[model samples]
Target: MAKLFGNLELVLIVGLVAALAIIGAFASSVVVDANSILRWLHLFFGVLWIGLLYYFNFVQVPTMPAIPAEQKGAVTGFIAPKALFYFRWAALLTVVTGLGIAQVNGYLHTAMSFTGEGAVNLIGTGMWIALVMAFNVWFIIWPNQKKALGIVETTPEQKAAAGPRAMIASRLNTLLSLPMLYCMVSANLG
Candidate 1:
C-alpha cells in the first residue's frame, strides 16, 4: 500500500481504474458521453494549472525573497523546474480539453463568437479568458521561465529580466482566473 501510494503513476492509474469502475457500474443510470469525459478532463487540467499558479503566487513567490541565498538553489534548480513543466503542460491540456468540450457539446461556434445568449455567452467569456491565460502560460510565461530557471542558456542579465516577465504574466493569469472561474461555474448552474 505504501509503495503503491508512493509512486505517482501507480496512484493515478489506480484512481483512474477506480473511477472507470464506478462509471461502468453506474452506466445504466448515468448518461456517459464524450462531452462528459471532456468536461472531467478539462476540470482536472484546469485545477492543476490554476492550483500551481496560485501556489507560485500565494506561496513560492512571496517566500522566495525570505529564503537564504545559499538555499535558493534547491527551489530554483529542482522544485521550480518540475513545477513549471506540469504548469505549462496542464495549461495547454486544459485549454485543449475545454475546446473539446465546447466542440462536443455543439457550442464551439456560438461560444467562440460570443453570439449565444445566457449560458453560452457566459461560457464564451470564460473560454476567451482561459485562452488568454493559456497563451500567457505557453508563449509568455514558459519562455521567460525557461531562462529565469536556467533551463536554457541565457546571460545573467537576461535571466534577471526573464524572472519578472514570467512573474507578471503569471500574475495576470491569476487575476483573470477569478472571473473565468465564476463564468465557468455560474454558466452551468442554470
Candidate 2:
C-alpha cells in the first residue's frame, strides 16, 4: 500500500472502502434499508464538514503564522484549497441529507419547532445554527475563498481582504459548532 499510494491517498481510499463496506452491510441487513443509508450519509457528511471545521480552527489557523513563509504557500495555496473544497461541499450535503432524514422520519416540523423545553429547545437551536453555518459555508466562505486562493482572478488587495473574511466566517462557524453538536446529540436523548 505504501509503495502504491502516498499516505493521504491511501488514507482516503481506506476511508472510502470502510464507508462502502458499511453501506453494503446495511443493504444486506433486514433491519436496515435505504432510509437508514441516507441517514448515515447525512451523519457521515456532517462529520466531514464539522471535522474539517475543527481542523481549521484547532490546527490549521493556529499553525499558519508559525509555518515558514515558503511552506505557507504549499499549505495555503494547495492543501487548504483541497480541504475547503470538501469542507464546504460536505457542509452542503450534510444540510441536504439531514433535512432529507427529518422529512423521511416525519419530524421536520417538530424538530424545527422547538416546542417542548429541554432537549427540543437544544436540538432546535443546534439545527438552526447548523443551517446558518451551512449557509455561510456555501454563500459566504466558499465564494470569498475562491478569490483568496485565486481560484478566480482578483487583485492582491481583494485576495487579502477575502482571506480575512473567509477566516472570520470559518471561525464563526467553528464557534457555533459546539452548541450545534450539543443540540444534535441531545435531541435524540430520551
> Best by TM-score, which number?
1
- Across 1-190, the per-residue lDDT of candidate 2 in tens digits comes to 5664667777878888987787677766644655677777888899899999999989998999999988888987899899998998999899888777667766667778977567656766877898999989988899998998788999999999998998899999988998888878777832
In the range 29-72, model 1's lDDT, one tens digit per residue, is: 98889977888898899999999999999999999999999999
Best candidate (score: lDDT): 1
Off by more than 4 A, model 1: none
For model 1, which pairs clash?
none
Model 2 TM-score (2 dp): 0.82
Would you estimate the TM-scores of all the predictions?
Answer: 0.97, 0.82
Worst 10 residues of 2 by lDDT: 26-35
lDDT, each prediction: 0.93, 0.83
